[model samples]
Target: MTRPARRIARTAAAGAAVLLALSACSSQGSSAPEASGSSPSSRKLSGTVTVFAAASLKESFTALGRQFERQHPGTRVTFSFGGSDTLAASITAGAPADVFAAASTRTMALVTDREDAAGTPVTFVRNQLEIATLPGNPHKVSSLKDLTRSGLKVVLCDRTVPCGAAAREALDTAGLTLTPASYEQDVKSALTKVELKEADAAVVYRTDVKAAGDKVEGVEFPESATAVNDYPIALLKDAPHTAAAKAFIELVRSPRGLKVLSEAGFLAP
Candidate 1:
């Protein structure tokens, strides 16, 4: 071959080698994320997630909220804990909340029926009624009928609240008629009466009694089996932080969330 032709052939081969090297580097750069198990398109959650939950969920939900915040940097979780009925009413009244966790299906319906829930609520846990009394059995209240004894002060949650409704159901199952000293708006309030020694006993949730630790004593009645309440959670239709709210709900339904709730004395659904 001629020297000029040989020089041209060598130059062409060098240029092709350079092009191939550049192409290999570009391919490796594009696949680096996949190789490292990282997602380039995954969204970074930020802002606050406002959760309106039943008072009974305070302990478990608070722990779950902290876990969520840690998993998602720059995100915050704030909670509004109250009676399911009241929280449902607030959600229906256009109260700004990212999520709602109710203690009963009936209360959850109040929000679902009004189209305030973004989707069908999921029942994550169940709770049963228990008689909460003073640290010791000062009244010897061993059974549901014991609360009916004359002069024994007892408190009950209002009929509108899930705990109140469950208490009534338990009473009906036992075929007993006993009036309470006062009807409180929530289970926590009723439990508070017993904790303060103002009432001899109060019909509240097993979870609440457990949460109270030694502050109160819990008595399980057989009738409570018939009055177990299912707890449901949902994302709000008008959630300001839609993505973050959904993520938080996912965490609540996850196994880790269930573990936290189970530790808090809540039964799995």
Candidate 2:
């Protein structure tokens, strides 16, 4: 091989490398340019969106979520329903979630104060505590004052659940205090005790009172007015589906959403 031939081949290789580098940069430019401090290739908002909602929002949210998925086509809305405080703790601990819908403003504050929320939340609904009694109201219990009667077996939500907090406020407003047989973790469980006929009455959310479907009779007391619970919802700071989270939130504040909540006995915020 001649020296000139060897030099010509080396020059050709260098030129080819330059062309490849330019081609790669051009390809990168075709996609959305990454913002400063971000990765070169950004992502699209699609796939699953996880929502951690309060247990009381279960029936209404489950229906709305299906509608949300239908509207978004490829996107899915997955929900984890539980006590709002429990959900908040899970989110703060790095659970993969896109949104948080709480039964109480106090619970929402826990997430927001931690800077876990993306934006200020909006009030979606209001709830008040009610007396959930056995079918047919056998004991003739009518008010928070009635539950204080010694003979009745009563169950109430633990202070951790929003309903319990509201219950305490209602009792305080009425100038009454209650001693329950047990403090259930959530309204559903407390109501379940009534449904199963385990307890004569349980203090649970008004929506839960309705969802019980005649299995329990709801007794609304005047003092519940002072203990109205505001339901707040918001998108998380690290939402995996910000758009969908915003959409779901919009749905909750929409007429359709309000109707679902209202029919379930939630009051307008």
Candidate 3:
């Protein structure tokens, strides 16, 4: 081979190697995370959030949970819906929950007092008690006094739960004392009695009656204003998924969250 030809070939090979190296460097830099200017907090999150919410929140919270999962793919939301007092007890007893959403401030105090809550509790919504009777008002039940009618099988929540306490407050405000055929441990259970026709009526949250659809009828009483329960939510100190828990709380306090709860008949706090 001639010297001139060899020199030309060597120069061309060097130029090609330099170009390939420069291209590889540019590709590596582009592949690094944060290239899009997204902060850690704004990045997509994935994990499981276990929420302990009140029985009255089952319908609304379930919807919010599904929305949260959709907004943050690869995330799971597991809920334990029941009496607020019962849920507070579970959290105080060290249950593995990321968030606690109670139907009343009293129940939330139980967690906050024990330092189980990560921060100060915030009131998200308020709920009022209502008389749930058979659909179509078959018995003509209309007011709080109607619940005291003789031969009416009425059910009330156990006094330990928020709904029960609210019912008692409403009854006291109306100056009426009536006996219930059964005392249910939770609002859902009390509502179930009327839904199943086992009881003629039940004093439960307005949201419960709304959730029952056409299965039960709701009667509004003026006394309900005196016994409105404030719902408070907080993050747990020992949350297994802290970031996911925070995100879930933010979603619950967001405008979309309030819209879902309001549509279910819950009053704004």
Against the reference, the lDDT scores of all candidates come to 0.92, 0.87, 0.92
Error of 1 at 22 (Å): 22
**Which stretches in model 1 have alpha-carbon errors above 4 Å?**
1-42
TM-score of 2: 0.82
User: What's the lDDT for residue 203 in model 2?
Assistant: 86
Model 2 poorest 10 in a row by lDDT: 36-45
**Candidate 3 lDDT, tens digit per residue, 79-143?**
99998889899999989999999989998998999999998999999999889999997989889
Point out where model 2 deviates above 4 Å: 1-45
Query: Poorest 10 consecutive residues of model 1 by lDDT?
Result: 34-43
Put down candidate 2 lDDT per residue, 1-269, tens digits, no spaces.
Answer: 79999999999999999999999999888664444434211223367889999999999999998987777777788899988999999999989898899999999999999999998998989988788999999999988899999989999888987988988888888889789999988778898999999999998888898888989898888898898899999989998777667777877788999998899889999
lDDT of 2 at 91: 91
Superposition TM-score, candidate 3 onto the true structure: 0.85
Model 1, 152-221: lDDT tens digits are 9999999999999999999998899989899998889999998888988999999999999999999988
Estimate candidate 1's alpha-carbon lDDT, on a 0 to 1 scale: 0.92
